[model samples]
Target: MADPIKDTRRMIAEMQPRLHPGKYVFCSGIRDDLAADVANVAKGSFVEDEGMSFIIPQEETDRLGIAGGVAMRQITLMVRSALDGVGLTAAVSSALATHGIPANIVAAARHDHVFVPADRAEEALAILLARQAEAQVGS
Candidate 1:
């Protein structure tokens, strides 16, 4: 495995945002049998207390009867960011906020994933790319 990046600036500059294929929905109450069902159909991030707020494909959501409405698309930041890294999420979210994009971020062991409105996925990606470009030029 490669070393995780700790520099906030480098992380942002090199985070090649890649759009995940498929429309996804946010689901909750994925415990017990429901949890098992979700596991079989889709993979997603789980947060305790907040319940499982992970992205499940729309088709899987519909077939599994998971209650989700707002359609979203996943944009994975292809930067191996350290979990302890600072300012990465802040910078990304700030840029998106400036563009009036709502971002639901999930930081995994290796990468950060942002879920944005399905219709604005392209726009969100452009915003992220621009942020990265600015970081590169500023460095």
Candidate 2:
């Protein structure tokens, strides 16, 4: 794998955000015993105070009878960003917030993922792309 980018500006300029190709939903209240089962089917899962929160495909949500809310779509930042990198999330979230889009961010070892309302996925993408373009021009 390529070295993770450390420069905040370059990270934003080359992040190459890509939208995952499906609708996802947030489901909670999954019992610990069932966490493994849900994880096996979910695209992403996180532990929360309420229970395990699973970001699962809409189809699986229906199939598993999981209570889902706020259908969302994932935008994967294709930059290999360092775990301790600063400013990337702030910049992305600020851009999205300016457009009144709520962004739920997940930072993994290799990349950052943003989940936005399913209906506003394209708009969110446009904002991110524009941010990147502007960063490139500035640099």
Candidate 3:
């Protein structure tokens, strides 16, 4: 019998330390109402204040916000190797898809993070944790 959770964890173990678990919320960078409401908001590499309108884990937020709805999830990502190509992303995406978990992956030079709907964060964590476990066992 194939244990999906075990397999997923195996994949995660082989990657770099990428997941930083926390409540990631969207906030305004420049204190602009339009930017706050829009789907596109600036991601702060460093949070000036934890009380900011939308404060996630200081590490999870990026320096620049792209054109996508940010979904907060508890499961952290383990990015394998420098994100020089899209292979890792495609693999992660496919894995998530198979689990019926929808995800939007953003890959940076140093690491990669996944944004899933806030409502689905727990479920997403279970999936990611499984992946992490799988990676550990394999290694």
TM-scores, all candidates, are 0.89, 0.93, 0.50
Q: lDDT value for candidate 3?
A: 0.52
Q: How should the candidates be ordered by TM-score, best one leading?
A: 2, 1, 3
Candidate 3 lDDT for residue 20: 50
Model 2 ranges with Cα > 4 A deviation = 31-34
- Please write out the lDDT profile of model 3 over residues 1-139, one tens digit for every residue: 3222223343356544344555465444433544443334333333356534433442334443422235565334554444344355566667678878777665554456776667776666666666656657767
lDDT of 1 by residue, 1-139 (tens): 8899999899999999999888988777765767877876665766767566666788987787778779999999999999998988999999999989999998888899998999999999999999999999989
List ranges where model 3 is wrong by over 4 Å: 1-11, 16-41, 44-80
Q: How far in Å is the alpha carbon of 118 misplaced in model 1? A: 0.4
Q: What is the TM-score (0 to 1) of candidate 2? A: 0.93
Quantify all predictions' global Cα lDDT against the true fold. 0.87, 0.90, 0.52
Candidate 1: give the clashing pairs. Answer: none
Cα error of candidate 3 at position 72, Å:
4.4
Sort by lDDT, top down from the best: 2, 1, 3
Give the 10-residue window scoring lowest on summed lDDT in candidate 3.
Answer: 1-10
Clashes of each: 0, 0, 11
